[model samples]
Target: MSEGVKWTVLGDDDYLEIANNGRKPVKASLRIAGDIPYYGANNVQDYVEGFTHDGEFVLIAEDGTKSVDNYSIQYAVGKFWANNHVHVIRGKSELNTKYLFYYLQTVSFIPFLSGGGRAKLTKGKLVEIPIAFPPIETQNTIVSILDSFEELSTELSTELLNRGKQNEYYRDLLLTFPEESIEV
Candidate 1:
């Protein structure tokens, strides 16, 4: 553990799994009328009719393309519906949720993962993963820095996506020469 940090297991903390509130929504089922985000292992698959959880929480991918390799972790606020493939965790007052979210991003789940191909992060194993708990002030400071970076990242991602669309449009425009103008 780092200086002034207390090492603890997540299970021993106030974190709880609230993955079930209703039947987990499938991708197809999500297309129906809904206002809530339907969370999956790594991302929001779609919007669904109701929410299983409200307020702020951190969601870790239990198993998916990104679980073993990318260690996909997301911070969600407001109402949302999480599938069984995600592990929901809410932080205690001592431990900031954003800080936990940032800390989990640094973790490599490769060693802790199960299943040969699809890699699952079982709750049994997940709970035992050690977390370095610093004072609330330190955690909050780190969260502030990380949250700024995340905001910037989101802006860049949007810009890149828009640029890609523009590139595609220009490519299509330049390539659409008149059929009669073709030589040979």
Candidate 2:
């Protein structure tokens, strides 16, 4: 609700570039695939031959895991593989990938998720989630501010750990006693 900006559904064709398809059945993939890798055959790719997606994407868990307020979100760049359990989405020209990643953190998936035994965020419902479409410059600015804060937080944590180690060393040095023997 700002000047030069309007609200739009995420799945709107004008701004859509989502990828939650191309995954093959695990049994079918096994017949054509090879070399499961050293990390074991747990990767979503193991069930399929080759990669399903390439380039930047904001991956959101589709099933099997959930919390009341949030779900797992991962930002992936370059080539990667995914199964039905994750939804790989990205922006085309109008949207920015990093901006979406940041924005999704504030979204609540509980409203859109379905299923009784296992929660799932289906593709049909995901496209309907409303998103803010501020100016491109604003999106970039927000990302920059957030990134700077993250970097500073990491630096402060490291400094605190170093100071704790120094405190322990000084305490030990001050407590050291001169070498002496005592008779009982």
Candidate 3:
């Protein structure tokens, strides 16, 4: 929250759903190797032969582990197919889509979630979550800062993984005994 920031509910005008009519759930068995990602509650489980939406949009997991344990939020660019278990959202120009995506990640869904064992973030509950709307310039600045941090974080993670692999290779090479030293 910031000065002049207004809180408002996320409605149809603020975000648009590009998912196919009826929001059909594609079964895993029916999925085939393809170029487009088939998104579910937590992540992309498979690739489907066809795509329903194109361009950039934010995906919020409607149910499953992500809904309860980890607020599973993701961004998809280019062509993709979304099942009934995810809510596809594209923000209006006034609102930076990435800004909204980051804001939602910070939100706690526990208060809004229902259905005990398998917690769910229903459409009604999703829409009711208040959005802290800031000026476009402020939103852009926040997005830019976050984007830089994300790039740096990703680079560090990649470097760490590469180093781990390099370490493993050297360790194995140094510890190996000569064939003559081993008895058959």
Give the winner by TM-score: 2 or 3: 3
Predictions ranked by lDDT, top down? 3, 1, 2
Candidates sorted on TM-score, descending = 3, 1, 2
* Regions of candidate 1 where Cα sits further than 4 Å from its true position: 1-3, 14-27, 156-184
Off by over 4 Å in 2: 1-3, 24-50, 165-184
Candidate 3, residue 68: how far the Cα is off, in Å: 2.0
Worst 10-residue lDDT window, candidate 1:
14-23
- For candidate 3, report its TM-score: 0.86
Off by over 4 Å in 3: 1-3, 12-22, 181-184
Task: Provide the lDDT at 71 for model 2.
Answer: 77
Instruction: For residues 5-82, write the lDDT of model 2, one tens digit per residue.
Output: 657877886876777665433444354554321111122334334566668888777776646466777777766566
Q: Model 3: per-residue lDDT, tens digit, 66-168?
A: 4454588888888888888888786777777888889988888788888988888888887788788688889899999999999999999999999999999
Cα lDDT tens digits for candidate 1, 108-172:
78877888878888888888777886888899998999889889999999999999999999999
RMSD of each: 4.0, 5.1, 3.1
Q: Once model 1 is optimally superposed onto the true structure by TM-score, how far is the C-alpha of residue 146 displaced, in angstroms?
A: 1.1
